[model samples]
Target: MLKRFVVLLLCLLLLAGCDQPIKSGELEKVGLLVPETINDQVWGTKGYKGMLKIQSHFNVDVYYKEDMNSEMIVERAVEEFAQKGVNLIFGHGNEYAVYFNHLSEKYPDIHFVSFNGDAQNENTTSLNFEGYAMGFFGGMVASHMSKTKRVGIIAAYEWQPEVEGFYEGALFEDNEVKVEIEYVGHWDDDQGAILYLDKMIDEGADVIYPAGDGYNVPIIEKVKEHGLYAIGYISDQADLGETTVLTSTVQHVDKLYEVVAEEFDNGKLKAGNLYYDFSDDVITLGEFSSDVDKEFENEIHKHIEVYRETGKLPNE
Candidate 1:
């Protein structure tokens, strides 16, 4: 395994280190780098759909590489796409932003797009969603539905804006509500997330938010098996069960991909960090489950409307 790693690393380094000038226009060819398989039913799948959307509507060829778990693999994907004259590459997760920034100077002609991070180079663009609003509303649902007045969130990291949003939103809805947060160390650790879920349930949590993209589905399934409620994350998960999910905090990343394609088409695409929120319709709350109280759901909608119109959340 080490020998293979060394060989792959050396090959990719050679490919990327070559002083190849642009063989194509800035946006003529597009590439997508996904951290996991495209069939994961959440983040990666959304990313793949976004790539397809760009291909269908824009006058560009699209390429994708999945299961990007290592620095070597990432470099290999980028180098492979670069060889194909892909001057524009989209890293489907924030995990790629730093790597993109690192490669920015080396590949000055390549433009990189990724999520929720700072871009240090003129060739990199960081896309952020106003996740706080959705998290806050999700918190409200958890608090409202919890007979135990305790909720939990299994997040991959503390830097995620939605974690803070959910914490504060729960308290805002009910000051007595207790919120538990545990990180599974990374995005795809389903077993670790399950352990955290078990701990939360034992600690009196009646509702939980499984916020890790790859592991959330299994965690929600566990929540259902435990006869608890959950505030779904990333995708609309109300279909999981009628009473299992309260409301899903949806991030329509596919639509954001279309936005990027449109920007490229219109010659407005550039390097920088850009944020989208409820007003842009990028971050949203999905349909309320049948178990969600009608009155509480109405209140949540009112809060969303006020925030959309005035750019102020209730806690603000």
Candidate 2:
């Protein structure tokens, strides 16, 4: 009996020291770096939510540093994380990927993941969503809901995959719907987005989608002020007013983090590019808002049904 009890105690100790991966028990230490504050409620906030989801599910320790843009600052932040023996590091924004990739090369022992940029190194990986698929669905929804047959898009930058996705989605449903696109040149410039959106509204735009930073809140609110409907991104819960949020192209960041954490824990982690498309159900559509007409909303719902069932919508 004494021998059996000693063996049981040793087994318990071993089990306590081992982690079951991203699921739970024996937390693993991971670090996350962001280009902006999580309060941005757009891209940066999405990243924060993803990290939080990972923590909630798994026995994982997470450390975060936000509001870093410069290469030098990011480099220092990553280095500090490495010194602290963090097993995995996440660079939240696309702009920070390049620097993180460089650091990954210098410190091959660490595993690094980038949300936007392409993953090129053996020690680093990239994960991205297929914005085009979401954009296509958004366009279908906008086309059916627009009373004026006019929809407008406000993008923070001209070159991002997300911007292109929005453009393609809007144009897919009706080629003649008069979809207009504008670039504000900065990610956080809500004021610029509002100026552009107001101009489009004057031109008879009844629905506007702005893909800027946290400032998008102001732009959407401005649209509501003019009695126009608005769309959101990253998720559908974005509330600017009563009956606000026509829908959203939500990024399944929580799922991404959970899968990546599992791979890291299982010791099968590899450096490569990871892409999730709408067809894969990683990017999803939210509910249409009250501002949309019932008849039009039904039309949009039909398309959503197609997306849910067939994973494809009619051409934008």
Candidate 3:
């Protein structure tokens, strides 16, 4: 009986030790993998800002590698971070989901996070942005402001969710508003984006919304050169074309990173998918340009109040 009691006590102690949470300061190293140049002032720059926020808030060491476009480079960067004993590995785009899903098992000790992705794994957490809401906001603005009764969207690909939201929102605002959508088949195709922008302009689209990652640069420039109205995405791109860009649907990635970092510090971070939208205030529209009239701004504010009250967008 004495020997059996001792054995039971030892087992309980082992279990307790095994399940211990990490100490507060022990999780000190963070790694970020960015697929593009951090100065794009859009997706990549937002991610870089998020990393800086994490570093400042958590007082942790942060390391990052930009322009990790290929699979090999991504794999190599992740492995290097893991070998260096990083507490968390943040992959800053949907493209990193595949690699995170595969590598999380190999590095069981570290947590993996995929931004704007749907990756699910034992050690991985995915975060998807509310792109639909962004589109809806832009569409609303375009619908109200388009003098030609026609607006346009040039997307990187035919992702139906965002595209559909833009379509629905435009028509919801004014059923007579015609929205033209064109997919350039790639994210960074300046020439293709320009070609589509010209086509849409030729079709009498006065307000053009470009939804590609960095392609907005050329599209905004084209819209300004052609004296057309434009909507920006991912960041406050109003400065990209001062008078042309009416507003932008900004993604507050730094806030997302802050939330994640706080949860991690408290040992409350879980492996699953987390979503952010307008309801959470992580997704928002930038300040309206002076070109937007007070009445139109009030109308948009009314819709925002409804969304806030119901936790749903207009018609959603």
Candidate 4:
């Protein structure tokens, strides 16, 4: 009778252990917050596409709120996702980093991710886009395709790292290259971008590069109207003007999202900073126009090879 009692007690203990909650690496739900609408076809769209890829791959429940520019909206969205028991939350831009830092500690069970920003807390992780390298690629294409040896860039702001990188890359290609710069003070200032583009064209800038978010559209239109060569940024604008547009620098955000999701599933997601660049195949150049010669294409590939091997730009 005592032996029977001992066996029953052991079975009861095993059942109690099975009832205890176990934390696994399996992800169920995810949330995304974007500052602009998903239809922007650049920054916001790329993020939306990444979320969709994540959803398709993991079959996880994903929710997102676009055009969330205000702090209150961001906070509320984060709170709602937490309430909904999301395993992870992603802020598509640096604008949401502050909120992620504040809420991450309160919701220790959930992971907070910030794109294009630095991590501020233990529960938060960040992925920074290498804008400078992207600019370098654009400058290389522009310099190689310029006929007048005068390449111009119309940027949203002065002293931006990406703009500086473009100038450096142009100079690297040809020491005698004349590079012009103009700052429009805002990313979406169409009037200012057009005025500066005119000034650049008048100054003998045959190859123009626009390094702003929404400013590329107007500049590309002007480039087509003027029959000048232009290099695109962010998304592929070659379809915008087939012959006039040389190529574009593209950000492969879907790859980054895949890495994050795989890491989370493997229980390797940690709070820290993650850097991605040309070496990681995160920042890349889009399809080159047929106008680009074989020799120029070979030269561009050679530089890319050097960057891949050394993990540094030519001018770095």
lDDT tens string, model 3, 1-316? 9999999999999999989965675365889888877888787888889889989987788899998887789889988897787978888877888888887887888888887676779779998886787788778888988999999999988863567777888898899999899998887788999999889999999998888877888788888988889888878888876768888877888788878878877778888888878888888888788898889888777887788678688777
Number of the top candidate by lDDT? 1
**What are the models' TM-scores?**
0.89, 0.84, 0.89, 0.86
Write the residue-wise lDDT of candidate 1 on 1-316 in tens digits.
9999999999999998786764332367889999888999999999999988888877679999888877678888888888998878899988899889888788877889989888888889999998888898899888888999999999999888899999999999899999999988899999999999999999999999998899999999999999999988899998886789989999999999989877865668877999899999888899898988799899899999999999999888
TM-score, prediction 3: 0.89
lDDT of each: 0.89, 0.75, 0.83, 0.82
Arranged by TM-score with the best first, the candidates are 1, 3, 4, 2
Deviation of model 4 at 44, angstroms:
1.0
Clashing residue pairs in candidate 4, if any? none
Cα distance off (Å), candidate 4, residue 227: 1.3
Model 3 misplacement above 4 A: 1-26
Q: How many pairs of residues collide in model 3?
A: 0
lDDT of 4 by residue, 1-316 (tens): 9999999999999999999976455677888888767776666777788889988888778899987888888888888998888978888876677778877888888888986566888779988777787788778778877889999999987755678888888888887889999898876688999998988888889999888766787789889998899888777778888888888887788678877887887778888778788888777887788899878877787888898788788787
* Colliding residue pairs in candidate 2: 27-59, 135-169, 171-316, 172-315, 172-316, 173-316
Estimate the overall C-alpha local distance difference test score of candidate 3. 0.83
Q: What's model 4's TM-score?
A: 0.86
**How many clashing pairs per prediction, in order?**
0, 6, 0, 0
